[model samples]
Each structure stands twice: as C-alpha cells, then as structure tokens.
Target chain A: MTATTPAPSAPVAAPEPPVLAAVDVTKHFAVRSAVGARSVVRAVEGATLDLHRGRVVALVGESGSGKTTLARLLAGFYTPTSGEIALEGVPVRQRRGRVERSYHKDVQLIFQDPFGSLNPLHRVRHNLERPLKLHHGVRGKAELDRRVRELLERVALTPAEQYADKFPHELSGGQRQRVVIARALAVEPKVLLGDEPISMLDVSIRLEMLNLLDRLRTEDGLALLYITHDIASARYLCDDVVVMYAGEMVEGGPKEQVIADPQHPYTRLLVESSPDPGRGARDRDALFDADADGLGEPPSLIDPPPGCRFHPRCPFAMDVCRTQAPPRADLGDGRWARCWLHAADRTITQENE
Target chain B: MVTQFVPDTDRPDAGTTSARRADGDVLHVTGLTVEYVTDGDPVRACADVTFTLRRGEILGVAGESGSGKSTLITALTRLQRPPAVTTGGSIVFYPRDGGPAIDLVTATPKALRALRWTSLSIVLQSAMDALNPVMRLGAQFADALRTHDRTLTKDAAWARAAELLATVGISGDRARSYPHELSGGMRQRASIALALACGPELVVMDEPTTAVDVVMQRQILAQVLRLRRTLGFAVVFVTHDLSLLLELADRIAIMYAGRIVELGTARELYDDPRHPYTRGLRDSFPPLHAPLTRLTGIPGTPPDLRRPPSGCPFHPRCPQRFAGCDTDLPELVTKGGHSVACRLHEPTGRPDPVPDPASGPASGPASARTEGGAS
Candidate 1:
C-alpha cells in the first residue's frame, strides 16, 4: 500500500541549496494616533533565516514578537519593508504573471485554526479539489476525483470516500486539521510554514500532528517552518530553533544546544516558565516567584527599548545592554546568542542561579 | 497499596440528586448534569459530574473543549441561561466566615445576585470580551461594586477599585484608560482585579490565560498565586491545558465527556495516574525531560451525550476495555489520596481476567486497601 501511494511533495536529497531564504527581512506598519502623529509599529525587525530541504526550523516567540509577520513575508503574502527573500536562490519579486504563481505553488501556509481556515459551506472534496485544480490544473471529473482521494490518503485520512463528502463541521478537530494538511499538500509545495498549527488542537492529538509534520520533512523533504509559542513542541519536532522577543531574534542555534543551555536571559525565562512534567511542586513554586529574578513585560513594539529589545525584562541586563545593542555573539558549532552577557571580554557572572 | 473499588448499586435517577457536603469543602458538586436544548436531541454537555472544592486551595479542572468544563463552570456559578439547563445534581456552596451553606442550583435570582461579587465571583475567558469595551476600566469596577452593595458611596467604590488594580500589578492610574488602550496582559490583570473587588472568598477562573502568550500567561498566573496567598481565597482554575494544572493546582480533576474520570493531587496524577483515560491524557503531550517517543493519541472522538455509549462513556476509546466495560458503568471511587472511575480498579463485576501484577497500578493489577470517598 505504501509503495502504491504517489509522492505528495518534493523529493528528498542531500542538503545543497536552500528551498527558501530571507535576508535581513523587516516588516513595519505605520499607524497615526488621534492627534495625527505617525509612528511605525515595528512588527518584524531585521531577521535572517534559511529553510533547507528535509529540515524543520522553528520560529518561537510570544505574541507581538513579529513571528507571524515574518512567516507572511516568506509566504509572499506581504513584501518586506526592507531586505529580500529568495526561492531556490532566485530573488522573489513583487511581480505579476508567472513569477507570483510559481512562488505560491512552491510555498504553502497552514493556519492555526483549521475550523476558521476551511470554508464552512464547502465539502471536504470541494476544498481539496479546488486547491488541486487551481494549483496543478488537474481537470476532468475522473482525474479530479482520483487526485482528491490520493490527497486524503496521503494525509492518512483513510477511506477517503467517507470523509470526502463531509463538511468542515462534520469532522472532528483532528480530522479537520488532517484535511487542512492534505489541502496544503495538494499543491506539492517545496516549503511548508505552520503558524501554531496544533495550538487549537487537543493535547492527545497534537503530538500526532507534530509527528505527521516531522514525517513530511523526513519523507517528502519539504522545508518546514513550525512557528509556535510553546517551546516543548518546537524542540520535539524541529532540527533548529530561532527565539524571538519584541520583534528581534534573541537566539538561534541547533535545537539541542539552544534548549539544553539557553544563553540569553529571555530564553532561560521561557524554558523556566514552561511547565515540565518531570519536575516537582517546589519547581512550580520557584517558577511562580521566578519573576522576582526579573520582572517586566515586553516593551511596546512602536517604541522598543533602545539597546536590547529584551533588556527591559532581562535579569542579566548590564549598563551596556541599556545603552548599546548587543551583537550576535558566536559560540561556535552553529550556536549564537544576542546578549551582552556573552560579550567576549566580560567575566561570566551567574545571574539565574 | 492497591484498593479495590466497588461500583454504586443504586438505580439511575433522572432528576436532581441531593448530596451531603464534606466538612471544609467550599463547594460540593454531585451528579451534576447539564444539557443544551437545541432543535435536535439535547446535547448532554455535562453528565454525572462530581468534585469538591476546598477552602483556600487551588483546584484545577482539566478537560478537552467538549468535555463540559465550561458548562460545568456555568452550572456552578448559576449562570446557565435558556437553551441550556442544569438537568440534575446539586451545587452546595458553603459561604466562608461561618455563614450558612447555599444550594446554587435552586438559589433564587435575588439570592444569587446578592451572592455574586460579594461571596463568589468569576473571571471569564477572553479578557477582551469580558470587559466593557465602551466603559473605562474604573467604571466597570464601580458598576460591579455598586450593583452588589448600594451602601458604598461612588467615591469610596472608586478608591477600592484602584486598590484592586494595584493588587494585580496594574497601575491605579490606568483605571482611567478604556479597555482598548490597555495591552492584552494589562486588560486581563484588570479583569482579575475587578473579579476580586468585592473580596470574594472563592474565585472561579475559566481559562483566564488561554488567549495570552506564554510569558504573559506566566506573569498573570504568578500574580494570581500571589494574590491568592495574600487574600486567603480558594480558586477553581479551569483550562484545557493539564500541564499548567500540574504546575499550579493543589488538587486536579480530570474530566471527560462531562464526567469526573480522575481526581487527585498534582503529584499523584502526574506520577501515578489511575484511569486509562487519565494515563492517555498524561502521555498526550511530549515531556521535556522524558526521552523522545511517539505519543499515542486516544482513538475516536468524545461520545455524543444524547446517545452516550451504553456503558462506560470512554469504553469505545479506552485501550484497556474488557467485556464488562461495554455494559457496566463505573462509579468514581477513592482510594489512598486519589479517585478513579475505571473498571480496572473495581473489585466486582469481573467479566475479564485481570492483567499480570508486573504491569503496575495504571493497569488492572490490584489487591488490598479499603474505604471509599465520593469524587
């Protein structure tokens, strides 16, 4: 049965060229107050990342951290305020005709809420068929039906005949999400970006979805970007991690290194705040009072902190962190962190313990 | 020590069932059932649910979306409106400060109005929608305060309002700002402050942190814990995220298909889960420290309450299902410090042979230990 199934995504191979790459991208929205003075809401500040085939890189951050805006920039939904994006080494342009169509065909985005994303009135078959026809130009009644069934089967929605006739409301949450995934796969995109794809799902089924995404990366070689606030799932599924705070990338490295020994104070707080089942109640009490270690909210994006965006909430904030922005200090072995604490000359002082 | 559970033999009753309260229990719920009366068969949103809320202790209610967590909260607060009815069970709320216990299920509207904000209050989900969008944050507090106590002057009420906001880490001056002007985290903190304006002895929070980001959620939870410590009030925290409960709750109740499947301390539930359904839920999320392994999601969706499964509502999806599971209902029975409602722990109605003892307590292996307690 596995041999009979057709490949639904790009073929996997040794890492060579990146499927998607963004160079110092930025997105800003200008807002005018009631008095008419204008200011830019820096939703995303200069960020760089690459998505390679057969790899998953996660964009992890809290709300208002500009992760979503960055995802939109890569998906071609919005052109960057500054910087550029390339698809398979070719610069992506805001042009009409063949360029736009080809760019969209190679990239697909699966939204957070499956219930909201899928058309309520449309049947599963219609939702799957429409995307297939629009993207791949599949035609004729028999061929369309065959393609639709194949799409469902590829997503593990077996007995495609049974689910093809049901509407979005008729299926369960997990099943609905499967349908959404199948629709994204229908185009056979080289890259997939999921923005909190399983946040709306039940815990029991969420792991299954994450596993499915990992399987796609391993088997189909799709360059996947999983954007989420929950770090546990990011570590569980992704090969690399990028931690964002207030529209800035605070840390980026391999998942194991970053999670094991988070260098940035913000990254440490995130790890500390996340509820781990292995720990006991004393750890929880410590977590509750951990704010005493450093207590502040994310600064306003419109007027972020002058130096480090996270300095306002950082425990290890130094005088330099308040006056000058810290450079991305390379710790070698594909690891780096944005913090004054990692400065080359400064003696390492333990702030968290 | 393993305790064998004995199933309740009483015949099923379709109407309200009165329950005796446990001492020190702020709220005692027994056999609570709620149904949404739509055009078709009524949706049994909550069914035969039972639990106890202790004074000054944080009790966490964990469940999935359709598991009746929200409906159960509404039923407890006497906020269930038309199209939704509390079909059965009693909600006994013992007023703190040595006042008389009141049955909220049958409480008159006048009595409920007096009870709200003064003795008990609710912090609803979605802070954006919960606050009055057009009104200033202070006026909303004044409105809640004045509606409950007409004796307090407007100036005095406003003064108290500022104090409440301060308690939740919000500046008192921001009370003048409209709901839109405040950030999401600030608005949520203000809403919690308003809920505490009357110094309610018990606060019912329904997914109060669900919409916020993780960092904000952590801050809010920390503030709430600090406030609870200072004010000496019990809290009933409800959310679909069990991991949060494990971190915060003194006691945790796992609900499924509107039933209390398991009730125990956070340590007990996390380290030694009794019900198979509870085990499945605990295993659902990827543990940060545990070795990477494939998670096994429970098969099949929650059963339709209108025509719920003939026997155990979870039998269809339970991995340890036996011949008796499809026909006999299991009652929540307490042993040691925890309670479980699965046939695996029950001593009687042996329709399937028990598993080997080496499999551990989560499975069917059991022997000595005695006594029972209501869920």
Candidate 2:
C-alpha cells in the first residue's frame, strides 16, 4: 500500500503522492444545434492537474475556459469522457454507488454563490450537523453540539452560539460564506475544490477569506484546488499556478516563475491584463491600445479552431500553429508551456532572433 | 419651468462658483440626497452628495455593495422607481452648444424626454438587460437614432448604426444579428455604441465592464478612452474596483455608507489618500508586481444604512479611529483639488495629533501641523 522509497544516493526525499490527481481528463457535452443536428461541446481537453497535501494549485482562466468543468471532474460531478481521476494513487471510477460515496468523503466542492449553496429554510446548526452525522456517524446530541461549535469557531465565527441558530438570511454575505466553509469542514475532507469562492465577496473582505483558506491548508494539511478567473488573487494564495485557455492548460509552473516570466502567449496576455496601479497612468493607453486587435473573445468550444485553439487570436501564431498542435516545451525546473514559439525545433531560434 | 428648479448660481455656498459655471463643466450636482422609504424610518441612500464633471473627463465612483454607488447613478440619470426617491438636489447639465444649463431634477417630462439620448445617456452593467432581445441589433440602433432625429430616414439611420458598430470594433455584418446571437463582450460593446448613438454630452456608466473578463474589460475601456478623445463626451463611471478606476478614471471618489468620504485626482487618491477608508480600500486589492505581503483587509462590514453609525460611517471599520470620531460628524473639506471628510485631515479642534501619511496603519500620532496646515 505504500510507495517505494527512494534510493539512499538520492539527495531529496521522495515527495508524498498527490491526494487527488486528474490525468489527461477530457469532458464533452452533447447538445442539439440550432438546425437540429447533434453536436458536441468540447468543454475540457487534456487537463492534467495534481493536488498534494498542504499545497495549493490555482487553475486560472476566463469564462468558457472550462476551469469549472475540470474542477467538477476532479470532484466527480461529471464522468470524464477520457482519462481518469485518481485519489491517493488509486484510480476512481465514476459510478454512482459506494465508490462515489467514499470518494465524496475525501473530497468536497465549494461553489461561488454561498447564498444558493446553503438551504434558506434550515438553521446553520442543522446545516453543519447533517454533514457530521452523515460523514462521521456522530449521533449523540452533546457530541454534535460540540463539533458544530468547533467548526464555527474554526472559521472565526466567534462564540458559535450566536450564529448556530441563525438562518442563512440573517447572516451577511461574508458570514454566510464562512458558514459554508464551516459546513465543508464538518466532513473533514482532505481535498477542497473551491470554484471562485471569493469572487462574490466584497473587495474589502476578500483577503480575509484567502487568509483563512491559507491557514486551513497549513494547519490541517489539506490539499486545495483554487479555481478562479482572477490571476491576482491566485498569485496571492497559491503555491503553483496553471493557466488554462480554451479548454487547454497553456502553461504551468511554480507560482513565482510562471507569473513573473510566463512562456505562453495567453499567459502573458492574462498577466498583463490584470490591473496594476503601479503601472500608473502614463502607459495605460499604450498598454490597452496595443492589444486591441489581439484581444479577441474566447473561441466557441463546439467548433474550436483546428490545431491550437488559440491560433486564431494569437499574435505570434505560425502556419504550424494553425495546422498542428505544439508539444509541451520544457522551461526547466518543472515549468513548461504549450507554445510553438518555445518549441525546440521550429521557431525558438527565430523567436529569439 | 426649468428655470424655477435651477438654484441661484450667485448663492455663495452653492459650491459652483461663477468660474466653474463659465468653465467647460458639463454637469454640476449639489446637495443631492436620495432615500428608500420603507414602512418604518426612511433609509437614506445618498446624503448630500456633490461633485462636478468637466468635458471629456472620467470620474470614477468606487464603493462596496451597500455604499449607494448605484443609487447615486440612478439619481443622476433620474431613473429611480418607487420606494426610492430623490429628496433633494440639483443636477445642472450644461449643453455643449453654450445653452443655459438645465436642471435634471425639475425638467418637464417633455423636456427630459428630449434630452434622454441627446444630452445624457446611460449604460448599465448587464448588456442583455439594456439591449432589446427580440429586435435585431441594427434595428435597435436605427430606432434610437431615428427617434432622436425625426428628419433622418430609416436607410440613413441604418447606415449610421453600421458605422457606430464599426467604431466599437464589431463588424458591420454582425449588426444583423440579435442581442443573444453575439458573444458577451460583443453585446457589451454594442450597448456602448447605442449609448453613443446620439452623440450625448455625458454618459453615465454603472460598472459597464464588471461582467466581462479582464482582457475584454481592457479593450472596452481602451475603446471608451479613444471614443472620448474623438467624441469629447464626459463620463461618470461607477464600480466596486478601485484598481480598475486608478488606471481608467481622471479623478476618483470613494463612497462609504451613502456619503462620499474622499475625492481627488487618480494620482492623489493612489499616492496620498487622507481618509483611512480610502487607504484601506486601495490596499485591499493585492498588487500584481510588488513583493507579496500579508494584507489584513478592513476588519468590519459596511454599516447598515437603516441604523448607520453615529458620526463617520467608516469609523467602525477604520483602524485609525479615535474617541472624537464617535460623536463628531466631519464635513467634506476641499484643499487644492483633494477633498476628504475625515477628522484626521481636518484642521480645527483636533483632539489627537495627525499621523504621518507615509507610515500607514501602525504609525503613532505625530505633529498635526504638517499636512493639516496644508489643507
């Protein structure tokens, strides 16, 4: 059941296996076209990601980039059309039975809207207690009360009793989200998949929520997959960053390396598009005007461009990009990018020149 | 009839002096107040708000969810429905042709109808709501144009609609499609084009780019700047994002709990914000390039407007609050171009010494004479 230990000659210790991993996962949704013909929406393709204990990985992209679909695949909401999801090195089948229930025990998904997630009719105490009873089988009244208070207090809802009996409507947006987090914690899951958790929060309170998540990761050794369209927030919280564009992982690496020196054109565009007041006013017009033609909307997933999905909008797209998908170019230190400009054989030298 | 609603411009405390009236000012608002009347006490949404917009200038209003930014916009455009009423104010909009300024609050229904798309127009956050779903995009534009100018024929209006669509980077052919046919970014751009259909002197946009992604937001903002330069229409843009405002707005106003706490040029608000709330808001957005640091966001939520805090609405959440802040309501005082409504920046009867502006939250009280004297 254990992984084979590394050799004595190896300097670094063997890292623990990822708690959750999605290998070459792809999802396709079928729909009827306007003309009444069957068609497939290629939502996600070849999305590979891993969430390790105490480490945070950010899946960053815009709307229609299939980041949510990838998260759902990891959470077992959708059965992947191809590839597999493995938990703790064991492959998981997407069947609706005991296997799925056990998988749900180890993983949880937090949605964007806290108001919609929690039942308005139920009290906060009932919300937190049901998960504990179902997941851990704690039946006694006293035990349930103690555990519920602990969950609320862990999320900084002080005194716990004040909030336990309140309905979801009585709480503020941030408080409601904290209650949502408290409910997620009651199950004591090892992996948390947050899909735009803080995007709905007020700007003045978003950092507090991020800090809380970071504290949870450090204290409980939980693996987190943070999905968001905002790159700035991802940089603030994640240990590693993965950039997705048009249902593909365009670039990924350690947070500092990938964000500071992005290799893919889409990643570069994203990093530059994030608003930075330090850039000041003088160069703003130039920054925005220069990319006017290149700022095309994301392609339709139903009939995406042939080879590289980004080729049509990419400024540096070559003939090969239009005809053939480029292989991953290694940027060293575990950083890589899917781009023709970085490919070793064809255009790297020309790009440098 | 409109002259009856216009306040005496010669009044000493009108906030609009003869110099400002004669200048290139496009819109001047003074003592604007809005309230939401419930069965119980009325909830004041906008309290004595005042500002002026110059020709081709961009004024950004930034605040959180309940801070009344949207209410101010509704009041400014005279678009508020029942339960929301503008209790007091004068919104004087000056025509570009050197005509006498018209008071929007008191303009007749016929006069207001004449000015809706010609002198002032609005763009909302969701383009789908602003645009007609059943009508073709070209038809919508043509309807707006031909209605405003009765002399224009349908064919001429359609041609102008295509050109207007082209200005926002949408292809002329796409004008035939319906609102639901285009992408989200394209639909938003079409709304902006529709707002500019009559060449209005002022455009009031409430979070126009909030629904789109950052790349599209940048493109839309860039087009707005370009169009402003060519068309010379002033803008009043409202959003909850301070960082976006810093890059796009010429001047910025920070609102909290139905009042403007700070107003200054973009550079002033970014570099030397006097109000503690402004500083906290600016820091709440994590920097993109600066070395990462742990930021403690402002601790408390915005005050409830129904039972607002005694003095300053932000004092409960402000880290630099003092004993006097609980009782003394500070008036907005302007010095040079920057204005703030914080006791920390006020000059008279100061209980505590002013803290240094450079040293952020932890800096202890220093001599009050430094920046207080400047104000």
Candidate 3:
C-alpha cells in the first residue's frame, strides 16, 4: 500500500532568501593586552556568505581561520565588530539580540563533544524534553515524554525506550551525537548549527553519523551550517562549501565547483593540505605547506593587510594586490571567489603550482 | 641468504625485505584478553585477540573505538591498570641475545620497568599531553633515560638526550624548549625521541599523528620511517586512518568488537580485502586529490562492545553475512597469506560458494575497487 506523509516543512510561499546573510561581514576582535595598547585579532575579517533553505553549508578552515568566530556571530553569541548580518532580509538587531532565548528555537547549535554538551546528571530524556517543554509550550510529563521519544526516533535513535533512559556516559560517541541531534530537533528549528559533529568519533563510525545528518537535512528540509577544521568531512557532507581564511570568506560556491575548480589561493591551499582518501600520490603536505605557513600570524584585522586582507599570505600576491583591495567576484552559477585573480581575468585562474 | 630490513608481509624476496632471518618474531601475542572491570560486570576490552610483531617491521592495528586496539597496545606496554585487567595472553619480547623470550604478561613489576623504554616503549598520541608542560624538553628525555638506566651518569644522560634530539629531526636548540614552545610537529618528534631514548627494540605508538596538522603529520610519518630505518626496531602503529596506515605499515590488522577481524600485508589488505567489514571501512572516506568523485560512507554504526552482537561483531553491518554468522563466531583463519575472520571464505580451500546476489552493492569479483587509494 502506498502511503502519503504530510509535508515536513512549511509550504514555500514568500520563501525567505537565506535565513542568514553576511553582507561583506567583518568581525574584528580587539585583543587588548598588557604589552599592546591596541592590537586587533582579525578573528573574522570581511567575511560574506548566505545560509539558504534546507541545505548543509559547510564553513571550512583551519584552527585560526575564524570559522568558530563566524559561527559565534551567526549564533548571535558574539556581536560583529564590523560588517552587516541580515536574518530573513532584516538586519540582525545591530547587537546581541535581547530576544536571543526566543530566537534560539529557530536556530539551535549542537557542540562537538556529546559528553561535554550534555550534563551528566541529566538523562537523554531531560535534555530533549527541556527544549520541547520550553519552546513548544508542552506541559505535562506524558506529553513531554512522548515528544522527546519522537525527537529521538527522528534522529534514528529508534525505540527511544532503551536510549532515553541512559545517561551521557553510558552512550557511545555516535549514540550521544544522535541524542544531541534529537535535542537540537526538539524545538522544530529551521536551522541546525553543527560544530565539528564527528571529529572525536571513531573514524569508521564517523561516516555513519554523517549519513544520518545527511538524511535529516534532505528528509526534514533543515538549513544546516556545518563548521569544521577537517576539510575531508566537509567535502563529504556539505552541498555548498565556504572556505574561511583568518575570519574572511576567501572562497565559497557549490561543493563540486569550489572543490574541483578552486579560484581563491587560500581555498586551494586548504583543499590541498587536508589528506583525502581520494587524492592520490600527491604529497599533500608539501603541496600546501611548501608554500603557505601553517596558521602563521594572521594580519591584525584592526589594521588589516594594506590592501586585501589575504595579500600577506597569498603566494601569487602582486603590487596591485598589496595596494588595492580586490572586490569579490561572483563568477556565475552560485560560485563566488574573493581574489584579485578572479576580478582581473577568468582564464588566469590557475595558481603557480 | 641474510634477511635485511624486511616488511612483515608474507612474500619472500620482496624488494624491501631484509636479509635478516625471522627470529620467531620480536613481539608474540597469543589469545590476549583484557577486560575493564565495571561496578559488577567486566567490559571486554580485548578478547581472544592474537598477533605477532616481527623485528624491524611495522604492524598496523586499525579499528573504531571499543575495538580493543588500544587495549591490546596497553596490554603489551604494561600500561593497562587494575580496572582494565589483562585477563589472559602472553606478550613475549624476544631479546637479541637468543635469551629466553620474556613473557610480559607474567613479568615482575621490576622486570617490567627494566623492559620498558629500553626494550619496549610507546610514542603516544598528543605529544603535548605526553610531555610535562612545566619541564624542559631535554629534561624530560633525561628523566626517562636516568629512570630506566641507573648506570648512566647525569652527563652521559644529557649527551644521549642531545643525540636523541638529532635522531628525531629536532635541533639541539629545541632541547631547552618547553612542550608549548615547539610546534605540533616538533613536539611529536620529541615524543618519538623520548620513546627511543633507551633505544627500545619495540615501539607501541597509539594515534601518534591523529591530532597534528596535515603538514606536521606528513613530517612525522617521514621521520618515523627514517628512524625505523636506522634504529631497526618493530613498531605497533595504531590508528583509524586506513590510507595513512596503508602507506606506512608493512602489515595491517583490523580489529572489531574486542577482537582481531583481519590481518595481512598492506598490499593484500588494500588490494584484496577479504572481510566485508574491512571492505566497508576502506570505502568510507573521500580521497584528497579527486574532488569530483562521490564518497561512499558505510550505512550503519559499529556494535556496542558492552553487549556485542550474538556471533560476528560485524554481522549487523556485514553486507555478505551468512546463516552461520548468526549462530557461531568464525575463527580468524588464514587464506593465502592474509588472516580474516569471515565464514564466506572457505578456510580449507581458496574459493567459497557465492551466496545471496542482493547482499551488497560491492559484491562483485574481488579487486574491483582495489587499485590506487586516491580516486
């Protein structure tokens, strides 16, 4: 017998373009120390990208690349020092919104470690039920329990009977992640913000968790912002990719376009640097590190690189590149690259590699 | 014919094969059983796992968490403590002098210490954590040598530490540096030097390169290969990165639910993996170079070690699981040269009867996807 299930998400009407958009967004953090009077950690310099409806968008970069800072700004956990952040066509209230708690239901975050994210004393049911009881106005133990179980099942922690009763320590890394997923899905949030979802997990089991998330985004139609240092995982999961360099969107586009035909030097360096099971014989280490230094001192954002913020590390940097800030070029087909090479000539795309 | 620096692979006359004769393996582990004693019931960390590490050869053990890989390493190193008891097994260390091989399992506490660092050592994952933040790099190296060899004076220990610094690719200046001062790559190098302080014959490294950046990891791998060339000691290299293991390891072993599921030379395991679990694992991650190719991740999660599946630990996820798999656990039988724990292969003969055509997407003739690792 054929079955027809009710459509999961709301009907597409006005269809708000991108739940969140960074219009030339730049978040500069002032690092005031005893030694330095005014030094800015350009944590996130002129970064711009948009998170659209029902797709996993990966913000990939190394440790000091400002990926986390961007996530914080998007979460409204950190107020951007500069650059504009728009949510649903309306500018983010210029400050960490006073209605953050209320807005949290729409945009929920899941941390890297499930053990660290969930409290030890509380059970899985506690973590899941709290979001439902608070966000959905579900009162009564029975209703909260039923909803929590449903949430667990949605993330594929089936039966929920066995898992809901367990504590954080009792579950495996993968299972704990599923619980975290269930908790994030509790409020029926439109957006899911995942920070390194499976780094600490067993390498073999990591794929299973990634597949689960993929199903959620496709089936439930949830907008996902995947933040990670591991580029390989990002390549596997994200539909579209954003490469962040010292807190700026150096390159962003559809996964195949960006990953296959990278324009920005930083994006090329990052993709080349990470070890992929697919990339053969090429000494990835020498390919990436032989040129750029590993997370070497990023130029101060308060006083960003004289012209382009990336000129300092750009291998193909020229006098014009150093003196003049290159405008971001959207090279048709959802592909946008911020580089002098792209702005100057399309055919001159290949790096000196 | 004298055996030189040979890999642990089955092939005789292989290019890298050393002229040195096999001295009955440097490290022999048989029926190793370790259990973490919970409040009442003990969790089987490693059960009936068996393997051998030959002299001047690298043996790679790979598995997801709770696969008993770390437990097996811990049992060998005398690191497994009270809660994690070595229920059974004999970890034998074959000395160079033809002296009776020492059983690490029943060795005296004092003997265990004497054997450690000097004869058997470990290069741990997170060299930052392994190194004391407060102590200087040289000081920590000296401490390890002095603690192990009381005969060596302070001056002699200092000189040896400096030499070790050079051996591990760390400069003399780095000796005075703290763990924080050295970069991730340098710190890991120092840790390898520390493990090599007493010129250990066997080194047990657990995820040594997992935490570091890709550049540092490559540097570390190259350094390990260089050191092994000069030092002539066996390494028990453990990690989850199969591709890296394939590149570095001479022989590879796959662990699953507290037992060894498959063991073979790198060429054999990567080229023609026999076990369905091993095959599924190798196919999971995306390769680095090829961007357009679609990656295929395994569908299901590994079984819990606490109460693993009835028979085969991988039965639930195994694509070609048979009826016997539900009732009985198969032995880790040897086929050709590779050792695998799957009933699908006939232990008595080479080819086994093919069952269920609709089992898996990749159940074609073997060696279909066994070419180059990178797409």
- Top-DockQ structure, candidate number: 2
Candidate 1 ranges with C-alpha deviation above 4 Å: A1-15, A281-283, A290-294, A346-353, B1-22, B356-375
Per-residue CA lDDT of candidate 1, range A251-289, in tens? 888776677789888888888778776564476657677
Q: Per the 3 Å backbone cut-off, how many clashing residue pairs does candidate 3 have? A: 19
Query: Each predicted complex: what DockQ?
Result: 0.38, 0.45, 0.27
Model 1, B1-375: lDDT tens per residue? 221222233322222233443456677776788999998889888887877677788999998878889998999898889888998876778777656667788888888888898889999888888899999998999999988888988888888888889888877888789999998888898999998888888899999998887777888898888888888788999998888898889888899888889989888888778788887787776555444555556666777677788888899998888887898988888887588888988878556667723422233213211110000
Worst 10 residues of 1 chain A by lDDT: A1-10
Show model 3 residue runs off by greater than 4 Å: A1-16, A28-40, A94-98, A140-146, A264-266, A279-353, B1-21, B38-41, B96-100, B145-171, B287-301, B348-352, B355-375
Candidate 3 lDDT over A1-353, as tens digits, reads: 11111112223312447776766566766677777697867787666666766677898876667887787777777877776777666777634344676667777788888879888899888888888877788999888878887888887787788899989898878889888888888888777888888887777668778777777777887888898877767767776788876566777776766776788987775665565543433443343332232333345456667766778777788888898766666676667777888888653332210
Docking class of 1: acceptable
Q: What are the per-residue Cα lDDT tens digits for candidate 2 across B146-191?
A: 9999999999998999999999999988889999999999999999
Per-residue accuracy of model 3 over B227-266 as CA lDDT, tens digit each: 7878898899999888677667788999989888889987
Q: Which scores greater on lDDT, model 1 or model 3?
A: 1
Model 1: per-residue Cα lDDT at residue B250: 89
In candidate 3 chain A, where is summed lDDT lowest over 10 consecutive residues? A1-10
Q: What is the lDDT for B23 in model 3?
A: 72
